[model samples]
Target: MVAFSTDTSPLPKTKKSLQLGNYGTLMSSQEMPEEYWTPLKLPPEKRVTSSRSDLTSVATDNLSELLDETIAEEQTTIDRVFAFLGFTANPFSSYADDVCNNKASDMRLSMLSNISAAYNAVSISMALDIMQDLYETTSKDKSLCSSALIAGMIVGQLAGGAIGDILGRHMAMAVVMSLQIVGALITACAIQSSFSIYAFIAIWRLILGIGCGGVYPLAATITAESNDDTKDGGKAVALTFSMQGIGYLLPPILTALLARFVPLRLLWRIILGFGAIPGLWLMVLRLKNQIARTNSQVYKSKRNMLTNAREVPVNVLEAIYVEPDLFRKMIGTGGCWFLFDVLFYGNVLFQPIVLSAAFGQAETVQRGAIDSAVVSLLALPGYFASIIAMGHQSPRFIQSQGFLMMAILYGSIGVFFQHLSRHKFALVLLYGGTFFFSNYGPNATTYVLPSLTFSSSCRSTLNGICAACGKAGALIGSMVFVFAASKFGEDIVLLACAVVSLIGMVVTICCVSETVIHDEQIKKPEVRMRVVISEPSLLDYFETA
Candidate 1:
């Protein structure tokens, strides 16, 4: 076994203009971003505290400003609905796909924040071999140690979901990022001369895992929710997740460059310590905009826990139960993610093993390093292609297409194993296709779909659940590749991957929606008219200032 250790390490809210629930036909407006997924649906009536007297009592300036914004918001809603109905151009590309990036720095920052997860992997990949010797651990112990990191990440993802919904995205991001720095440093310093060192290392890796895993949902949802511009509506979100490709290549490149000069013991420490730098920088950058600005669309779209709780179920279970379609979507997204990670992690962790067998083992360190870097590099195009594809196709279409292509590719490799194995170049081409389709297909879509599918109130929570399932699949993929390769040989393992890919295709076709805009608009269009308002709720845009 090549020792599977380091792989796949991969950010809101507001109070309201209190006393504003369905004032008559007043559903939510475009101000509430969750409503942005589709046309605003007029909500059913609730408590009505607003009367003619109360309206007159309010200041004229406040009322006038509120009405102006509301009218503008309703107008935006009207545009989106007409666009959805094909009466106008797309809301995103209406003026020929002008990107909104110049205006969305906070969102772009949230997208880059996910790059920190890649740093966590670097520490483990660089330290693994050195620690095996220093700790005098058995191969079993080494594998277990790495598993500790993955386990921590898995648990952290689950908890992070609830924390995100409960505390808001920015706060949760800041908290977890601080924890990551502490965990990385502690793990770097775990170089004592005793068996206890192994225990110490494992504990800290687990801690780091929690921080790393928590970033997935927080960063992804932040970008997805904050994104307001793109000729291709989902391109921003796709770019956000595509950063993972750069993350995977970073550790090996760093290790290769540093190994020549640094002392072995000191080298591992430096590598692990380095993971904290990106997190520190990002934390400070994020704090500068700790909360979204009041006048911004990003701010208006927030899901308020204090004032909007009555409308947004804090508990995901309650939300799903109230709307069974949510339950079905949860299954679809979760299942596709689960299946994709199984294939992705399996292929990435074992690539070196397969490459050596096909190309013949490299006789020199330089050659081996080059091979590793090349394999990682090949996956980048797929990530880049997915961003472009997102501009034109629905996630449902992209995901299903990717899965079907992968199934065919894996199946072809399996059936012609003997012939392809003999032709090293042909086998290499086939192998690279897997990474291409994986990134282009379900890998990016799994993350993108959940962020857009659910309402802001439960977005992080739902996306967290979906992402955590991917981690669970990671554990299974890493283990399965080992057992199947050992027991049935590599050829059979490839065939089995094809089978899994086929199942993923089926699940995606049945479960995933065609597009974020159309499905949501057709299902729940926003409705608005001043009915009665209850003091229990406030207008989302009304700030005391």
Candidate 2:
């Protein structure tokens, strides 16, 4: 019912050339006679009907406008949340040596690393219990069912990188963590209800794997970007990744405690359900702390927020395709990751079964839990050792050494399984040594290298691709190990893993480069400067001519 006016005053007369109305005529304002002037007039206004359909249309229009406004407000809130997480606020911020070396930045990255580790380890931890309870009793294809988690993870990791690029890392992480929470809750329910237990658990595990997969690249990339400026940037990144050791170490100890104190039947459900806690906490913190305060200040104006948002094109394909060199690097990094995980995840996921074989299936839950805990604990020192030595070592060297050592250890165990198993201490030492080397070398470096090699534009995607390759390898390895261990025996499986590690070592030496953290190479390009040229003078014009 708002009204609009269409009235206007005549323009003041021109001094000499007065414009005649669209007639290609000109007149002198001073010479033009007063009798020739005309007064301004407007047509009579008509009253329009406010019919029912018209009212309905107006109401609909008003509702649509209100909805649009609401959506805009919601989007602004989300942008602010992303800004708080430090992702969207400053698209062109420096990520040089000085910037990456900040104490605050390192701390934030460390927290993120820990959360990522916990998220990833959840499925593995649950796998241990599933092997004891459901796998043994269930009628379904246990290996295939168990491998579903890893398969889900592979898909999720690939999706996560693309999502991170398109949506921004903070937002992608939030969505990922939320998915993990949902997956965990569903898994807990499946455990509690006995109906179609194997199928339900397998489906839920896949969902959980997706969330875990999403964490890998994001955590590695964020940690690498944060620590890129420091002299110990690699050390910092390695330390952050080594947080996964703590994650691996926790489940056995937790399971041991639960077995001793709680009801035996409730243990698996409790373990599966507990994964939601850290994920929920992390998702909250990630959203809340996304953008830095300086970035928030810089982007206080709405125009700046819009501008910042536009700066980074969120197209994953464009990011990779635009830079062919980056895609080439992706092959090396992704390939190495694929090979490493074949050995690492394959062995780690089935470690409990290996232990059951070692100690006998008749071994009580508490003893099994304690022994697993003790063995898992053995990998921790290697992680800290890597952190200590990362500043001194090159990634290429560390990976090569780790892979070589793992091959040696695994080969020994495979070739002399009966001889080593006769001496329990020797067998444990060899098994734990493989873990130590894996953590110190390829496992840590694979995570760190991808972060440093690519431009920030496609770092997440590249990292995700690498991690997804690893998970795909994991899926293959897990399935292969189960089949091989059953048909060919554990010794052959171990030998196969040893061969895989050897292949990884060769790949590292031939394909992957020694990462050089050059500030200029990694830093986002500077905005182009437009030089203003002076107007041409007669001499300048003649000289040019």
Candidate 3:
């Protein structure tokens, strides 16, 4: 186990290079982001079990000694100042700006990452209405489609996170996007083919889920690294993330519009295939302009494979042993995320049930789609609201406030369920509030925090673990919601959600315990980080020379 340290000395000028402990890198401060020395404010950790992997825990005692010694010798004054200043970033990093000097290229790269961040919601939201055919035809379980997708996401995410750490974020992203497109087309084709369509759909949907889940951690990592420089940077990232609010609305809006003209069966296939568009367009954009590389040395993926492959577990342990309070941070980040998803997905997966309770059955898909769209309208503003709120408020504030508000809303609804039910419009608006607060609160912040908080080498991996916790929550919520509704009615379930949200608020306050109110609010989460080094991040992260 590594001991906690407070050393942050600059590297020796005579010694041109020092091998980063356990990371196997020999980069100097000269190899770091130019802004590392150029007046960019510093940054932001936790612990739990050292075994994040199944591999038997290797002793990190030597690794910890190596870490303390390396940190004492290599960390620059800027890193120390960063820690001293509470790890807050300036409004813009000259280093980040240098990475993509071309305005058009920068915007395209940002947009692509944003699309990646937002599309997971679209993948699932678009298909929910159509997948009902399984239950209708075979008298099978209704949640099969979502469950398959969620399950796929869990597996894909775990694998993708490790892959991102071992390979690179860019490569990992490309592979997942490819999987998403392939999964979409294959699912679409399955319906059109004469084969056992359910089997194919389920299998491909799992594939699609894997793709969707994998991208989320990557998106958050890319966006935060690229944009964590300024308040506007956070705003820009949050705005794109807000697109998820619109993502939830998009499918139903399209369905509402298209269901009038297209056949339901054919329309469903089109919707399934529609998942490919964002990933496809983003891939094309990357291939076209080509993002510039900023590092002095190009990554030799083949040469480093053996080196990086084994480090994933090492980094996971590094986070546990080296980073102060990392265990607690994981608990806070993962726990709050788990709780949020329980409510968020439960509500999302069962929107029809709620609507049916209020307005009777949708009677037709088109009517139901329109109703869904109307409620989702509130969510659009809610997402943008976070962009604005993030510019001024701490994510911790937003997260805690959001959970409390959600609890109040859910409890109020539960207490007066019959009254709200009698007033259908009131119930819909109240329901819509939950979606709004979700995006504005934990939803956006959860995406925001992990990217900015973790060490760059394991950033994607940690984000993956946290995001997987969220999907786990989503899976649990989706699974139990229908059964719980049958047993105790929606009112009891609403009260339970209220309680869960309260637990989330408590998790946010205690687990993510670092609180530093600053202008650059979101960039710093771990102000008291015990172990830090300015190593090259695995993504295309350095400035272009």
Candidate 4:
């Protein structure tokens, strides 16, 4: 994200020679010799006359020849500079991996994605606080309105995923992130702009939701494509996805911190507006260096376009019909996400209410903050452990186990709610256990599996579909959790979540197959270079008479 710097420190002219290719190769041992240097010179010419038409033609031909030679030399010089930096003059040549695989850049992209995920959830926790200020609304209405934000996000996700596949992941991310910032700014200005709070907030939230929806496909696909092997690729992506836990954790920690210094009235605005800051920073980073920059050339190449045009589905609907096996797999992946999010978001978004019900609603803010912080802290280890496990274990196995553990935990929590509520420590352990399995299991795997399930041409499209399905579950979960809990009590909500988890476990075990991509298998589809140029493709770098 930082600008490439020029070395301003003085150096001996002899040492200033460019180093070419790998670490050991040097372009020169000494300063250029006067004889080796070419200087542009032209021979004196006589003006052509009417009687000397043949001479005139000869002079004109000589001038044209000299101009061509000069231009060729200039092009050769530029080629030498490019080659020294590991670029090719031959447009047909596939780029070298060294030019493409930047570990630091990839990690930075992951960090940006983490920020995006974090911002997406932060708004959920702050929704009730925002609604209270804008209007006097009951908790159920507030919760329903909040679900609309995530609904907008789902709509955005479907669009973003399709955009990534059709246009390019980088371009899609750029557009998504830009709109997220605008959404945040607009939300912040809702009061100042004098627009109806409901309409304005809803419109802005939708924009924010779109940005959030795009993040999964763009981040997951770009990381998968960038790394290209199950072991390293899986770990790289899991590491990126795990940052969402930190995102989940931050809202409570930040709210707790801000609550001490800021008044409640102004706090909601700050929280809503603050979401934009991360997106803005990430947008700047993405602009400087995009996710998977090297793939852009391959995506645009004539051969690749023709090949992809025939092989890759233009959209998920087309993909479902054209590639039946892929469609079935998409169903498994998307279904798992749907079931998991029904449990995950239901628990996560309404953690405060659940805690209030358990501990009694006194000091709601402090209790919610304390409980959220504790649960989130417990979740971190799971995210990291999953990152390590992703390298050694099968994603399907991990995901299935997670779902099973969560189902057990959810059932236990629901059955023993009265008994556990009497004992704070026991309740915390049960709550923390669910959070742990959620990350180590389906939550992380859902993101990774979708990226791997489909071909490169349709990876984002299918991922988007899978993710959109998950968001649909989240929207439903968020909407129903408040009403269901109020009408039927928290026990029923917990039991339903447990049922959802059990279903997810079954779906994962039966439908979701292990993603078995290897390095060699992945390499074939990527633009592969048959040769690595050791020196610049210029006449000066070659032996000549």
Instruction: Specify the poorest-scoring 10-residue window by lDDT in model 3.
Output: 37-46
Q: Estimate each model's TM-score.
A: 0.71, 0.68, 0.69, 0.70
Candidate 1 lDDT, 1-545, residue by residue in tens: 01011121110011122112212222222223332221222232311235534432332334345545664454566456534433222223211111222114434445445666766854585577656545566776677668888898887777787676666665577666776788888888885664577678788888888988887887777666546433533776787787777777766677678767767677678767777776666555444433443444644333231122223344555544444377668878888899988876547644765677676786543355456678888889888788767757888999999999999888888788778757877878888998899889998899888877876556788788898999899889988887888888777877888889999999998988886842234343232212221111110112211
Q: Model 2, 413-497: lDDT tens per residue?
A: 8898768746767767787788789888888888888877776666778788888888787777767787888898888888888
Q: Which of candidates 2 and 3 is the stronger one according to TM-score?
A: 3
Query: After superposition, which runs of candidate 3 have C-alpha atoms over 4 Å from their true positions?
Result: 1-136, 139-142, 192-195, 290-320, 357-360, 514-545
Residue 209 of model 3 has an lDDT of 82
> What residue pairs are clashing in model 2?
83-291, 84-289, 84-290, 84-291, 85-289, 85-290, 85-291, 86-290, 86-291, 97-229
Relative to the unseen true structure, what is the C-alpha lDDT of residue 402 in candidate 2, on a scale of 0 to 100? 95
Task: State the lDDT at 358 in candidate 1.
Answer: 71
By lDDT, the best candidate is 1
What shift in Å separates residue 434 of candidate 3 from its native position after superposition?
Answer: 1.4
Supply candidate 2's per-residue lDDT for 110: 42
Winner by lDDT between candidate 4 and candidate 2? 4
lDDT-best of 1 and 4: 1
lDDT of 1: 0.65
In order, how many clashes per candidate?
26, 10, 12, 2
lDDT string, candidate 4, 323-410, tens digits: 4365568767898898888888556644664576556663645455666676678888888778768757889999999999998988
TM-score of 3: 0.69
